[model samples]
Target: MLTLQIYLNRITTQHNGATLDYRGQFSNSRLIVADFTQFVNDIQAALKSAAEKNIYTPPSKLFGNLRATPICLDVREQLADGLSPVEYKVLLETLMAVCNSRAVKPEQVLYHGKIPFQAA
Candidate 1:
């Protein structure tokens, strides 16, 4: 049910031209879908305008050897990211136990999951 709620929120929020909330309420998929939709629309509009103006697309070296593929770095995903379950667990635990009130992060916290809310 939470997934469905997130989806509904994404559609309504986007159509209403509201900023996306990613911290708590929105799910990863919801945010991704909404962002991708907007990105596609923007690219389409730009390309259409360029075509109308007869602007030639400059050749890009984004794809190492594949000219046909528009290799955008931001959209590329690392297969190892999903393959590394242990790494993901450690990362999530580190985020959850974050206790900094200031913008800067403190070092030397033990990874045994014993971080107190306050240091002092």
Candidate 2:
């Protein structure tokens, strides 16, 4: 399986008119079903869609604590395959652990299992 790691930095304005900062990272690991390049394109497309649609609702608890612009994101992913059973198991466990992690919201974690290729 391959993995994608995304790092983001967000600057938000607090209700009291102060500035709040957030820096964090997340990952999505899955088996490579298509060529590596294609897979990357698909992921980027999904992330872009999510961002454009404003699908990621910053946790309501943080309302009034952030601004809408100046959000920066960096992404990277593992491009190789052939993981040992132990490694794969650890990956799956990690995926599960973050599946519902408070640190990362479900919408913020963008993923689509299938990569669309050009029509044959």
RMSD of each: 16.7, 13.9
The Cα error of candidate 1 at residue 115, in Å, is 38
For each candidate, how many residue pairs have backbone atoms clashing (under 3 Å)? 0, 1
Tens digits of per-residue lDDT, candidate 2, 1-120, equal 112333222212222333333332222344422233343344444434444545333223454324322222222234354333443333333333323232322223222222212112
- Candidate 1's TM-score: 0.21
Cα error, candidate 1, residue 2 (Å):
42
Best by lDDT: 2
Q: Any runs in candidate 1 off by more than 4 Å, and if so which?
A: 1-34, 57-120
Q: With candidate 1 superimposed using the best TM-score fit, by how many Å does residue 40's alpha carbon deviate from the native?
A: 0.7
